[model samples]
Target: MIDRKKIALLICERLLMEQEMLRVNYINTRDSIGFFYIDNLLPVAIATAIAESFPTSSEMKLKKSLKEDKYISAQMDKHSEILEEVLYAFQDPQVVNLIAEICELQDIYPDEKLYAGGLSLMEKNQFLSPHLDNSHDKERQRWRVLNLLYYVTPEWKIEYGGNLEVWPNGLKAPQVTIESKFNRLAVMATHNDSLHSVSKVLVDKNRCCVSNYYFSDEPLKSSDTFHVTSFRGWPQEKIKDLVLRTDNFLRQTLRKFFKKGIVENPHYYKKE
Candidate 1:
């Protein structure tokens, strides 16, 4: 297991020290893709331990689609004690409050149910297509305002692919590559235009990440509107792009009528 209190304390101190710069960075990007990151967010030892705690890919659920190809799980009870602790450390009230302050967001809350916020593993050829996350929480009550992705796979490199790509200027323009570097904590604002995706993994090794989302009573931007998770293929894959766009359209249309949808999303952490 891990010491949640100790971890939260460490985070509070570091974020407090960088609060000004972090806020500035986020504000600067608020008009665009809207994101900021911190390298070596936790001690090297803590980061390494978290990575080591990752379960084998086979132990997780595979989600293969035109939108994404990866393994993810919220069934924390089946995982390590260290993982559950580390995952929720970011959920600690003080830590959550500090993050909301840094991002200049108000009335925010952490998702204990961890909807699409848990462990993700991607291997060679897997990728997440450019997309906007589902705007609201499971019940369509809270808006998902921010995404916290902590990459723990040691020695992951940009050249190795599986990097985070942001289309701030849209797909016609080049993407800004944010390496899925080891021990890096990336926080991105999520709304209608926060279009992003994970580049395809090139090497045979797995890219591991601990993910979370913070919800708010309000959308990140005044102009932000509601939408289902929308996806588009990478710029060059025209046929795939057409297919995905159509697919996203159909799903989104369905969501318009069925607010919660006919079938509930089984991706959430189902507490026993």
Candidate 2:
């Protein structure tokens, strides 16, 4: 019972209101980035319940650069019922219709497979280095067009970092940071140039989120080349970026041979 219909409607209404708040002059990039403060974004009880469904021991080990909370996807086939609810929210006909109408999206289809879209939680000192998401979907059949992130952490504070940072500029420059507030949804265009990441959480708090990516039959940019999700260290962390670049290069090369890369990232939740 995710109450997807109600949630979708609420989301639509919030977006309509916030649509006016989108400052074209302030957009961090040449492309688009919109944020909506959706009141009652999701049922608090349901979110807490869903978050508790998985045991602490079941949480996935995060990428090693920093401390993190957990990573869980809706249980693969087994949690289809719960998964469907989340997907329905992401694929709500009205949500899709509004996005298509507003963004002028060209051919928005319901993606049945969630890919790397799922839940992420980060705790104190946890940091996700600056990075660019993979330019294409797993099969490379669809262009990764949009990134939808819904934050659910209750009473999250500014000092307790874990904000989403988008670097429309190349990795060499400063980035634009968007705080991940509770009951808020962030939607942004995803192209090869869409560089983004999560800032480190300063305090001992958990930052949890729900994520989804929408893909199109065509590439987001005609000139967009195929690239892996590239990561960079802080501007001062030059050595870290060098190491990460090598890591990205190897992974990208492997992707050329293995369509899904060395091992399929088990980002989606799976049931026992």
Full-model lDDT for every candidate: 0.90, 0.67
Candidate that would win on TM-score: 1
lDDT of 1 at 184: 86
TM-score for every candidate vs. truth? Answer: 0.97, 0.82
Q: Model 1, 256: alpha-carbon shift in Å?
A: 1.9
lDDT at position 205, candidate 1: 96
lDDT of 2 by residue, 1-272 (tens): 55678667866776676554433322434353332234455557755554444324244446554312344554434443443565568778888767655555668755556677766667677777777777777677788877888777778776678998877666777777777887666777777777777888898767877788888888767778888888767788888778888888888888889987777776554434
Candidate 2, overall lDDT?
Answer: 0.67
Question: Could you tell me how far off, in angstroms, the CA of residue 85 lies in candidate 2 after the best superposition?
Answer: 2.7
Q: Could you tell me the lDDT of residue 65 within candidate 2?
A: 47
Candidate 1 C-alpha lDDT tens digits along 1-272:
45888888887887787888888889898889778888878889988999998999989999998789999999999998888888899999998898898888888899999998899999999999999999999888999999999899999889999999988988899998999999888899899888999999999999999999999999988888888888998999999999988988898899889888879989888987
